[model samples]
Target: MEHALFDDLVQSLKEARAIAHGQMPASRRIKVTAPDAKAVREQIGLSQSEFAQLMRVSVKTLQNWEQGRRHPTGPAAALLRIVQSAPDVVRKTLHA
Candidate 1:
């Protein structure tokens, strides 16, 4: 509704279009790859239910991540990385 805000929005849309068409490079880019949930679980020697419980997520959510229907983000992604690299630490910390 404000004039400045509207102008800024239009400028952003133009920038996005230019980026989409490769007319200009994006200002920033970030790439985050989701972990393989099933492999992490297998490496930890845990069942789906057990892994889900440890992750503090529902079994269906775990299944979604495992099946590639969805991705874990933010804290979940960080935890998955930890589980992959140092599963024993996770197990000890969580079981304690």
Candidate 2:
């Protein structure tokens, strides 16, 4: 039993090393596009203030996103994508 455990550990270590050195390629990759805040707002038919309120961001931040002066990151970016894809769902969910 101990020998089998050691063998498994060694195999795991070897696989980890191979992955660390890029000898093994990852199995999958996901590509995500960032949402365009201005376009999303327009599509949803919301003004800047309304959109900013819905997004829970300041007006300045929304302006920056609209003008391409700055970009959203992390959860904000994810939420924007969701909002872009389904504005009604997002609106109902958020308002609820």
Tens-place lDDT digits, model 1, residues 1-96:
999999999999999999999999999986556589899999889999999999999999999998889999888988998999999999899989
User: Which run of 10 residues does model 2 get worst, by summed lDDT?
Assistant: 25-34
Model 1 TM-score is 0.66
**Model 2, global lDDT:** 0.90
Q: Best-fitting candidate, measured by lDDT? A: 1
Count of backbone collisions in candidate 2: 0
Q: Which candidate tops TM-score?
A: 2
Candidate 1 overall Cα lDDT vs. reference? Answer: 0.92
TM-score, predicted candidate 2 vs. hidden true structure:
0.67
TM-score list, all predictions: 0.66, 0.67
